[model samples]
Target: MAPKHDLQYPKGAQNTLNRYSDRGSYDLEKVHKIVNSTPVLHVSFQPDPSDPFPAILPMIGQMGSFERPSSSISDPLDCYLHGYISSRVMNVSRAAIASGKPGLPVCIAASKVDGLVLSLTPNSHSYNYRSAVLFGYATPVTDTEEKEWAMEMITNSVVPQRYDNTRIPPIPAEMQSTQILRVTIDSASSKVRDWIPSDSAEDMANKEVVDKVWVGVVPVYETYGEPIPSPLNKVEKVPEYIEEFLKESNEEGLAYATAAGKRPLPVKAKTNHDE
Candidate 1:
């Protein structure tokens, strides 16, 4: 096994961070962390060669290793995406594999805003966020065991232990209707800005601009509110698992965002390519 810091996706044109490169990282852990944490990942692929536009779909995705179920987040892992069998992306991936192509070439992106950076100038205004982009080839999971495992993995990602809590095993119809796409990532990178506002030196020199403009960070985070029971909910009260997940997630999100708002900017611009 390689050392933890030695494990990283190779930097290339596809995954390089050009602008404000100081905030970028090619660390597999950081890239995967942003992807797994985000609620939705935007997957992009060209559906038709002749078409002018590429199709982008919002999907539920999780990073995990079926072969090594106990693997840590820092380890290399494939991205499992959950969708309906009839979805266009699933059909395209299936066709690509059938045609002898490696898989459907794709780009997946996930981003979460930690704070709003209010600067003295509009050009300097920016968002404190964690964003990751992954380039990969996606193929439909054909093996029954792997598909079912991926299903359970993805379900639990939404809410911890949700798969076992709700239903034992999916009915045949339910299994038939769902599809899982395993993306073999070729390269990936993440850009994260979790710091206080940065203003131009000229603007800082002018105390008038600083005095007039409100320069600060407005911390942002996803909040999970009190769970509302479904109309047909038979359980008298919410399960302890659900309550615990909500409490833990909400607290973690708020704390991270708050800390990001107060952090100092990155001291230097660095990228994997620089090495």
Candidate 2:
């Protein structure tokens, strides 16, 4: 769980961090990998009255990179090849190295997946979601070999086999021009709410009379359609590999389609509005 002090930060930052904290810990490695892989990260920070903050900061700047386990191997290239671009800002390059802060760079994120589950009684309303927030600081990657490893880790984090398919990253000059920040998390917290609708006896009795409209729920979901080949390409048939990519279940397909400009199919699931 994230410390109470950390949660006091900007709501927008918390939201962003929560969106990417897939496995609990405000995972710096995952966050950095996702930020670099995805394009157009949404970032917002209001200046604190007590301390002046940068007015026009980049989304990618808000979160910094972090170290990963020596043995762990996750490919980010797969995500890129599938069309998921990293959501980040390039301005992280300008942040000062010595802020004089004692702790490492830390960030918090939170998210609510569904609408508030309104109960028949006003007091019973609740929400269904999974949220996680983290706190940590970033360390710049300086070693040439380490930087190369970091880039590879970032790539593998998204796509398992991407490094094998793509050319190796540039060396020396190109690598030197790029900056990599490593984040070290201090603490984190996770919360969730998944429940079915429940109504009070009085509300149930008055349901039809109070509202003549339909009372049952209408399902909502995420879905995907067959991939459309690029117009410029002249392939006789959809490659089996590409077709396999299309067969992924809805959420995976939606994540992939988000960058491809393909419309995601709607999945059928009950909604609060329907009720």
- How high is each candidate's TM-score? 0.95, 0.50
lDDT for each of the candidates? 0.89, 0.40
How big is the RMSD of model 1? 3.3
**Error of model 1, residue 226, in angstroms:** 0.5
Determine which window of 10 residues in candidate 1 has minimal summed lDDT: 266-275
TM-score of 2: 0.50
By lDDT, who's the top model here? 1
Write model 2 residue lDDT over 1-275, tens digit each, in one string: 96532222223443434422332333334443334433233322223336566332223322322243432212211111111112122123124345554323435343434334545554544444444444444445556776666666555543445555466666566675665554444544454333344444466579564475332222222444676878886767866554554465456534433322222212221212112
Q: Under the 3 Å rule for N, CA and C atoms, how many clashes does model 2 have?
A: 46
Query: For model 1, what is the error of residue 100's alpha carbon versus the real structure, in angstroms, after optimal superposition?
Result: 0.7
Q: Give the per-residue lDDT digits (tens) of candidate 1, residues 162-227.
A: 999877689889989999999999999999888777766677789888889998889999999999
